[model samples]
Target: MGGPAPPAGPGTAGLRAVRGKSIAVLGGGSLGLYLAGRLALAGHRVTVALRPGTPAPSGIVAEGDEQWSAAVEYADIGRLRGPYAQVIVAVKSHDLPPLLPALAALGDGATEYVFLQNGIPWWWRGIAGDGLPRARQVVGVVVQHSAERTAPGRIRVRRTAGDRYLCGRPDGSVDAALESLAADWRHAGIPAETTPALRRQVWTKLMGNATLNPLSAITGATVGELATEPATRAVLLAGMAEIARLAERDGAGVDNTPEQRVARSAEVGGVRTSMLQDRLAGRPLETEALLAAPIAIAEEYGEAVPVLRTLYGCLAFSSTSPERNPT
Candidate 1:
């Protein structure tokens, strides 16, 4: 309805100044805007980085399950300068490569880098090379916020789940920056929390992505549709089972069973997966990170993922089909 109140001496109205930190959210998409707005509401000095040629809005607007607006600083990622206390990398997994140079230039070794991308991170298990600045503290966040960006600085959240954000370190250790950020989000009325089992959460979220993302892109179906339709639901369950086995073998056991995961997907209603959105917009699908990477890992460990392989093949074929409609 209304925007956040003015900061009281560079921090939350009644809180100490030190509670607020300088934060940069690097991405202009739904999750990025939502994080920027909510963090600003929590009295942090928030800046949002937009792509070149994208207009920077004066502030962020969030509607639907959460309703609030907050003024935030904006800059082009290419030109963004940072001595920021924390930098939240909210870009999609496929979009990270070109941004690496810019991200590597941000801040110093003490700056905390919180990566909030979907699927597994490149740095996990050295599955991919790391080009991030050396000595910088990096952490992962598994987000459960269901949101869509309607415009450059506007978002609509369809929060149907209990957890909104779960932040943690990869080594099952606690870090003050992540804990404080999660607390700030909670103070802003977001359901944020910290976890020691971040990798397990990563795999838990991956179970859904590995199953629903590619299927949604290929079938042009919503999350609920894929979870409820008999034909797609069977494939979804089988894929989840495969991912679960893979995760277990990799030492990051997922907490939910296939049935439970499907029930959660059904609860998200009609929201489309990000991969489906990318396909509809004729952008390259995140098949490499979300699907193919996991498949590769499964192969190395001798895990069977036939269902996931089939889904990946269908999605790859559909995304590149000469006759497929872009929209």
Candidate 2:
């Protein structure tokens, strides 16, 4: 959406997001903590919602010296109210039932939404099926370099590339407001940008997630372990090919080659896939979003995703009995 506009200046985005832009984060997971901490650190009035029956967050400050004790309040997403200028969704895909109605309750005709989730956006096509109010729905890709969840409310983000994110409309509505907000995200220690295209960005990241995340989870192996093993490397390459074909079908151009795609993952070292951590903790894997969705897409295109299909099926069964998986 490159349009004619004045070049970005110091005060251009300064007035947009810095003042009175209240943000509500949905889930109380590590992602919710990370975003809330940064936003709170940036002086935005922020609130993080925790689901019922979940323990209250214990710490006053995040793992880093980032202090969010004062501005960051805890609320329930399903019953949140307006006065919030924007809503940042950092919940698991399956955990939306409680929040949809609450967000609808806000009744603010112009509340911006930023969805922070992994894997494909195919589910959104279904959620937005009936033309759900399209006022402002921005897609984002976050390259979070740090990962640590020591306890329920405790998290450690060792490094962040500023706001290290990208945001824009999926249907090509490029304007100054979104760009200004993106700039604010950058200033909040979370490098961000506004892009005209989101479909490509989503899948490009999914290439590493679909392969690295699951394999690492199953093997209890780090990215380095998975990338180096001959058999694991072969599996990762095959998965990448399928993801590339799927992206092409959906009109997202990305390097789908095994060698190139594998490198993207090999760089992550011994990081534990979120799913692996969930399995170890006896929490439900985000199986439907991360694994099932891609397999469904492969079937839609009559494409064979043998490795992915098998991996998904195995994980599917294992979800019923978390301890059943040998790893």
Q: What lDDT tens digits, residue by residue, belong to model 1 across residues 270-309?
A: 9988887777777777888888889999889988889988
lDDT by residue (tens digit), candidate 2, 1-327: 322222212122332344646787776777677767666666787777777656566543555433233247776554567746667777767775445545644535566776777876533463453324343555454443545576766775544222246676666466776776675666665556666766676777777778887776677787777887899999988888888888898777664476876775566556677777777777777777777898888898898888788788777776787557545
TM-score versus the correct structure, for each prediction: 0.89, 0.84
- C-alpha lDDT of candidate 1 relative to the true structure: 0.78
What's the lDDT for residue 94 in model 2? 74
Q: What C-alpha lDDT does candidate 2 achieve relative to the native structure?
A: 0.66
Candidate 1 — which residues are off by over 4 angstroms? Answer: 1-19, 127-131, 134-136
